[model samples]
Target: MSGLETEKELAEEFVLAAFEKDDRRTIRRMLTSDALVYTPNVPGPGLDVDEFESQILDAFHGAFPDLSIAVESLVSEGATVVCRFTMTGTHEGVFRGIEPSGETVLVTGVVELRLTGSGIADVWQTTDSLALLEQIAAYDHENVRGERGS
Candidate 1:
């Protein structure tokens, strides 16, 4: 395999390990200790490896105990790998202060990862938060109708 192919394979393995298997140990091993993580869900500065594990990984596991990520595609060039994925799960625990609705949600997202010899060094992630919220009935439709005098 060429260098780029190898990096793509590694990126695939990392995603499977992190989301499919939910193997925190392997995920940790695949990331640099000080890896930078950015996601639309989190505010302020980007997260480090530890914060990513806790805030992103742990929180997702809690909210969606049976969460699964299906990779739609993965493309790589140089040190950067971009993965487009669809995530499916049921809301069984609190997520972002929203109470559990026992609703199944399908969310699509893309993640760009920058890799180094030491492992993954940086990550930028974007997901369809509005879709997730709609799935879980987070919006107050009746209130909106009332405000509009409908």
Candidate 2:
């Protein structure tokens, strides 16, 4: 395969494996020795290899009892993969300060990844968690108030 294909393939493999397995180990296996991960849900400036991988795996496991991602689009240039995808999961656990509402959410995002030697070198991702929260009724205070007639 071409260099671009190799990079793209690895990047795709990363997310697919993580989804299929629903485990952090899959994520770890996909990264390079020095990987950078950027996420909006996370506080502070992005994280390095160990911390980044750990945080998302924890977040996913916490946010969705069964979280998985589907690749919606992909573009590649040399060793970088730009991906757009949907993450679907059932909220069975607390997430983002909201209690479990037992709702299913599908959030979309754009992710840019760099590949190094066919492994993911770095990733920057931005996702629409607001839509997910809306779907899950995370901010249902108005509805609650209306029911109480307050």
Top-TM-score structure, candidate number: 1
Q: How well is each residue in 4-96 modelled by candidate 2, as lDDT tens digits?
A: 676666767776665535556777777777788888888887788677656776666777868778888889987779988898889888776
lDDT of 1 by residue, 1-150 (tens): 898888878888887777667898888898898898999899978899788888888877888889898889999988899989999999999988888999999999888999998999998977898788888875876687799996
lDDT of each candidate versus the true structure: 0.86, 0.76
Model 2 weakest lDDT span, ten residues long:
15-24
TM-score per candidate: 0.88, 0.80
